[model samples]
Target: MQPIVHPVVGYLCYAGYVRASDGEAPQGELTVVAVFAAVLPDLIDQPLWLIGVTPVGRTVAHSLFGGALLVGAVGLLARRRGRTDIGVAFAIGYASHIAADIPWHVLAGDYHELGFLLWPVTGMPAYSGVKSLGTVGAVDITTLWLEAILFVAGAALWWNDGCPGVEVVRRYVG
Candidate 1:
């Protein structure tokens, strides 16, 4: 998925977490950070591919270890300020981003089959039966529609429940 889509999904996922945890949704800056964390893994991985790391090394960044480190590091920092919830929220959003990206990448064929899905259990690449999204041959009208809906939903969440404080944190910390 593109950066825009990743962040939008991240916002929605964070909204869900906030609503469930605090009986209120996150707004403003929190939305921004959540979106950023959601796409952070991608940011870490793609550039490395250009440098070449075999299929296995490329998959490492996308795996649980790398993600856990990201979440843990953020959590540790947030703990100093008594904002554990915020750190957890970012981690959750990041996990959600990875989860959401998998299906589409599988469908696209552009995905590296480097066993990212079976972390801790098997380090071998796992191939699925479905064709990759990139292998769809012609235009993917359905994908475009799905992306549009997700974007609108994310925007609506931000407009309705944005918190200026959260945005501030994201801008400074993220």
Candidate 2:
């Protein structure tokens, strides 16, 4: 999945959950947290790989153990701060990222790509044909189409949610 697709999918999942459970749209700082969390795995792993700190793009950050530890620690901290909602949003986003990376590979029985989910317990296979960040171009047509569709769906959902974070962006960017 493209970097752009992750946050959109994350927001869609979080917003859908909020709508289903709370009968309301997600908004405010929690939305920001969720969006950031959506890409946090890539943010951590990519840099480490680029700097030669790790041998692959999926390392400690992409592992189930890492995700569980992060979510648990954040949940406990946020609960103590009386903002469990933030923790929930973060978990949803983080989980969405992990979920988004799977399915296609699983359906194809390419479990080697998923070894990173186990981290040290199972070594991450080097991505076929992807050696470095500079070599990461040329997305497949099917992936492009899927990304476009997801982007449209996410945009429509955000608009339906009354563009929750627009004001924050406007306030900060302007």
The Cα local distance difference test for each model comes to 0.68, 0.83
* Per-residue lDDT of model 2, residues 14-41, tens digit only: 8988889989998877787888899999
TM-score of each: 0.69, 0.86
Weakest 10 consecutive residues of candidate 2 by summed lDDT: 128-137
Model 2 regions lying over 4 Å from their true place: 129-141, 172-174
Per-residue lDDT tens digits for candidate 1, residues 52-102, read 753433355567787877788999999998988778778877887778756
TM-score of 2: 0.86
TM-score of 1: 0.69
Top candidate, metric lDDT: 2
Q: How displaced is residue 156 in candidate 2, in Å?
A: 2.0
lDDT, residue 81, model 1: 89
